[model samples]
Target: MKFTLFSLCRRYPIWVAVLLLYAVASLVSPAMLNPDQVLNIVRVTAFLGMVATGQTIVLLTGGIDLSVAGVVTLVNILSTGLMLGDNGNIFVAMLACVAVAAIVGVTNGVLVAYFRIAPIIATLAMNSILFGVALVYTGGAPHGAAAPAFNTIAQGDILGFPASGVCWLVLSIAVAMLMRKTVFGRWIYAVGANARAAAMMGVPVRLVVVAAYTLSSMLAMCGGLLVTAYIGNPSLGIGNSFMMTSVVAVVVGGTALSGGVGGVVTTIAGALFITELNSFTNIAQASTGAQFVIQGVLIAASVVVYRLLARRPRA
Candidate 1:
């Protein structure tokens, strides 16, 4: 029994840490521990979990989408502008939003896959471009009332649970199954594990890379839309924090930065851990500066710990 538990911890160190954090939080803040807080954390996790889902796929393909933050902001600005405070036109605005994400995704893929630009550089450039466009379009201050129908996707709850949680669960299961059960999914892992080998084996490497980026951008856009709904307004830089957080969540979920070794299921758990961490900091009254420092240290520490664990030999 002892060895079985130890093996489980080694195999899923991130999950062990998450459970430990929750246990500590419950003990430290007994008054703050309640059903409502747990439910709120679940809802918030759903939002980040969706973003993490896409990031997981991209990371598994050995790519990262730094422009998710910018794409999300631009989606909000464009959708809000189109909605024009009208719920009836929400679908039209959503279509426009999706189209924009598709365009950005293709551009990122082309720059990285076709032009042979580095993933970091390509996505970073895209982020700057998108950020500039959003600033120019919104004049740096975005203000628009979200459509009621669209807003309900984030706000409405069914059976006493948040709608976002349900959405996240459905997406999580679908994406996990997609990656596990489909040929294309296998192709993604193969490409990530070794793009050259995957192509040599007759896999459509470039097409798969493009699709990965496109899917990631679309999910980020979806998360952005939900953010707008949750906040009930369009806000500039609303997604500014998600880019790094998503990457960290992916890493903490035990997804390799080198790619081809992680899944959305663990990524969801990582997202929940992060959400709880954020809440814990709030409860502890940590300053913004302290939080940033702590977060940075966390990424660095996670990398180090992962490497150490990976180096450990088994009997």
Candidate 2:
């Protein structure tokens, strides 16, 4: 019984951390327990959650997508610019955003999978290129407004629940199912676990890697669109925060940095934890610097905890 408990804890440490965090937060700010406040936290978490879902997939394939931050910003600018607050333009704007995102994803994938470029360097370079493009297009000042219908995606609620939250939950379930139930999902895990071995087993390693990167970029774009809608305006550097938070959420959710060990479901908990942490800090009037420090410490601590748990022998 003890061993079973330990194993369960080892496998799902993120859930444990989340419970502890909520308990402590409730103690510090009892108002945090309110249903309205809790729902608000879920609503805000949807954006980060979407980005981190893609990050989780990339990480599972033993890669990183630093370009996700850039994808977010670019999509925000492109979507709103094309939409120009006109509802009729929404379809065209969104289609353009997805096309650009797919191109970016495919490029990153080709660089890393086909050309053997390091994932970090390749994605980082793509990020820089994207930022440059955004800068050139926006002329240092992005201008546009999200249409009322577009804004409803993030700003409206359904049956007293946040629409964004509902969307995220539905999407996450679909992704989780895809990863668990499909042959492609198995290929992803196989490749992440051992690329050479996967290739030997006829796993089409290159294709899997490319698909992972493509999905990452596409999801990052989705997240960016949601953020654009919520704010109803395009803003430069709007996605800068996701660069750190997405990876942090993935790591804290018990996903192995070395890859092949985590999934989108746990990332959901991780996103919630991160959003709650930020909300609590804001309520406590913590400085931006302090918040960074807290997040940094949390990441380090989670890494160590997971490593220790993973290293422990099963009884």
In model 1, the clashing pairs are: none
Candidate 1 stretches greater than 4 Å from native:
1-3, 313-315
What lDDT does the true structure give each of the candidates?
0.86, 0.91
Residue 113 in model 2: lDDT:
97
lDDT: which candidate is best?
2
lDDT of 1 by residue, 32-79 (tens): 479898888888887788888888888999999999899878887888
Lowest-scoring 10 consecutive residues by lDDT in candidate 2? 1-10
RMSD to the hidden true structure, all candidates: 1.8, 1.5
